[model samples]
Target chain A: MRLLIEIEVRFGEFVLSVNESLTLDGVTALFGPSGSGKTTLLRCIAGLEPRAEGRIEADDQAWLDSKAGVSLPAHHRMAGMVFQQALLFPHLSVRKNLLYGWRRRGQRPGPDFSEVLDALRLAPLLEQRENELSGGEMQRVALGRVLLSAPRMLLLDEPLAAQDERRKAEILPYLKRTIREFQLPVVYVSHAVDEVMPMASRVLHMDSGRLQSSAAARVSGGTAFGAILLGATLQRQLDSRLAVFCVGNAEVIAFLDSDTPNAREVLLAVEPRDLVIATGKTDAPLNAGAMDCTVRSIGEDETSGNLVLELAAGSSSFRLEHSFARHSDTVLRVGQKIRVLLTQPARVASPIVQSGTGRDSA
Target chain B: MIRAVEVIELDSLWLTLRLASLSTAILMVLATPLAYWLATTKAGIKPIVEAVTALPLILPPTVLGFYLLILFSPSSAFGSLWVQVTGQTLSFSFTGILLASVVHSFPFAVQPMQTAFENNGRRPAEVAQSLGASPFDAFITVTVPMARRGFLTAAVLGFAHSVGEFGVILLVGGNIPGRTRVISIDIYTHVETLDYASAHFLSMLTLCFAMLVLSLVFIVNRRYPIRT
Candidate 1:
């Protein structure tokens, strides 16, 4: 589904203006610091913030169009939102809370309540009062409650922020399972980069209520290199050397010190600073591999005048950072003539091997 | 002599209970929204409305009663308007006494409810709305249940205060035995007639009832403490 959002809202002294479009077939994280309007943007998408002005369309359906005066109320939107606090009804039992939305919409049962109960490990707390449950348990129940609503899209605003590490770890697997099984588009708002990096397939970074350039990238795995390695075929040789036997249309060479007889696939990481950019052919005795690459874009880091070069090897693109003085010697611009020389082998590390597949990967 | 005095006291007790119960019921239904509005509204006129609701608390009972009497009299504009609508004069009637009791005891009903709503906070409602509940649904399902203690406090206070209302009832409805005269007015009449025995008995009953209501408020509030 295509999710397009261009909205501006004012809250007291803060004004939030966002213009973004993302495909919602997978999880997208709205990542930002606290009070950076991550939650406000999510609320706008969910139709909870009425003051927002602009157009929002999900799956080509116009959910909000300020000029056309077409704005759906929160209830009418086909989205489920989970808050930081569970905010479960004190008088209602866990079962009732989970079934609240089901009963409200009178929709046919989509996900089995019993299955969800087992997934969230809430079977033991079905009859428990809201106040009696622990914070982690409350969040689990809250997630179940929203899922039972059978929404087309899910909006979560820091669901795990209030929990401890143990609780977060406990519920993350179940959350992953739900996302995989449902395959619904999800917009997760969070300030924790670790959480977003793990769960989001697309990360949209926000700062001071504005979308930052280069903050939107498809996050497939822990590192950009790991994502490339997932689909690449590799050959490991002696002398702690590894070769990317095949990477789509390009080949890469790296060094691996580990010897595992059954190791067919391996993970790799490369620091941009470790890479050297060259405009001419150089034969050096350094223990590094060279690959032919073209410069895609060149930009400078705001804090440090270090040049960040976007380079493409075949269809795969990666980044390399060079110092300001080095970059100044070369005339670098978008579509500039350049070659990236890896002075050292890209460090190869064992794949962390996530428990599940890409389902949980936002 | 004691048996006859007990019977008369019971009659006044019954009148007091009837008036308090009816007035409390009316106030509860009416004040719930008022309290909710006071707790949540950002309307420019909220302060004015709140002040009007709390006016009886600061006004002397006699002064309040005098104004109510004038407001409910047959010759007054308000009274004539009520008569035209209901085909009956408001003053010196059971309905008039009920109106007077509600006005006098409004703050008792509203204050506790307002505090309860305010203490419960707006987070739950916002969360509920995000979870697909409409505003009214959220209020009834999430807010009302959470603020249960406040409702109880308001109900008890409104009932007890209405039972003790004297000046307003006296001025508006007068001592019309079994019709408009409540326990407080009954005690006044008994004392005015030099029946010290009857007056003393009725006053003690009123005191016990008030204490019971007050203790209930304390116990309920303590047991279900609000955590905002």
Candidate 2:
């Protein structure tokens, strides 16, 4: 539940310096880009990367402390790691692969064979060889194989990267189900924001190996397929198109992708380019997906001659980019009151996070 | 002359098989872990250990045989100790030739096994460990299975090299009939005595045996191709 990780590892010239403590009880997402050392952080936590020097404590247990010369090996650390590539033992059948850990653990704290077989729905694929399984099936078997060995923590390093979109969509729900059903703390590494929006209770934004804690992602009903989502309570549904909701005391209208949920609030992800900001208002109605906002900062786009505006609307903030070359009506400044608009209709997601973590709170 | 050559061939063939098989079996037991260590260890002395293991590959057979002859003689400390323990002279014995053959063929056995273990990579073992297996358990279960081809190559190479050995065994074993004179030495002795037919016969047998073993190795490698 509680983890304190402080480590400095050098891989040739690329030094990964991480000094942060985390509470990873329920699906904590390590959100970062490639080469940001997200995988390295996971490896260091699992005690697989020995080049890192520092102290790590999980649930009152000391997993690593370099100054004290106490470094537990990966096996003794009791953590299950899933790599990006499905690293199933190709020599063994799926059943044997699962049992490799079961036999090693032998009545340990982890789930038994029958339980794992049932939970992962691996009954049909037991006799199949690793090579025979599809990419998604192989990854599921790998996950089950790791889970069979009683582990104190779960570290998934972009487990869906190798899979196609359909495979990724297929496995993601199962992953969320596993974490919830088993109640295991997970440190998930991913570069995609939409991927972790529904499952991760807490989000840690990482860049260049530096970790910064973000808002609570607290997914209530396991939904992340939304293209554009915001934390809003369902004030009520007027028709299908016109629905009003409260985003931190600001009444806003949005176009929903599906039927309005019985639950109160819903969330989804939207692209930055999809959002448009108008410097001067021209009688655009509030029901047309336009909300009043204070302009925080405006910067020029050197690449495309477009102007980017950072706007804030009652506890929520989102960036909007516009072409100043075409609409150079007035000069924009910091802290200017303006109206922001969503040109396209956004699908409101079912599961919502309260207050939204790092939804441009800055 | 034909009858004499057949008799020598039968005796020398059996002796060669016994020596090669015994040395290879013992080396397998000893070298599995050693080669694993050599493959995985990040120690500062790894280069030195590697160089020592490879010495037999390039060292002159006569040079190695001369050193073994001195080391096994009763005048030397090792030879005296061996004599005291076994109640037999270390030099001019079957045990002496066995010892020399093992040293001469050490590189052939260890190199392939070591390379295989190295090529297997540390990821598999690390994966095993993360699955709650101890390091030793991971090595035996995961690493060994992955490196089986290397082991196969090592065993066949060691057996064949020991079977074809000549100079080292001769120097240490002194050409004792029915005891230390393996097939290669038998061929050498026959040629020395100008017994051309006997030499040719034994040489042909050994050549065919080596070629068969090597062919088997190639077939196994081609079939499995455990590189990935």
lDDT of every model, 2 decimals: 0.72, 0.75
Q: Interface RMSD values for the candidates, listed in order? A: 2.4, 1.9
List fnat per candidate, in order. Answer: 0.56, 0.67
Supply DockQ values for each candidate.
0.34, 0.43
* Model 1 lDDT per residue over B1-228, tens place: 878767767776888898899999999999999999999898899999999999999999889989989999878999999999999888999899889899899999999899989988887776676567888998898899888888998888898788878888888898887788788888888888999877887788778878887887788678765543
Candidate topping lDDT: 2
TM-score of chain A of each: 0.62, 0.69
lDDT of 1 at B158: 90
lDDT of 2 by residue, B52-89 (tens): 98898898998999999999999899999999999998
Shift of residue B116 alpha carbon in model 1, Å = 1.7
RMSD of each: 9.1, 7.1
Off by over 4 Å in 1: A212-362, B1-8, B211-228
Fold similarity of candidate 2's chain A to the true chain A, as a TM-score: 0.69
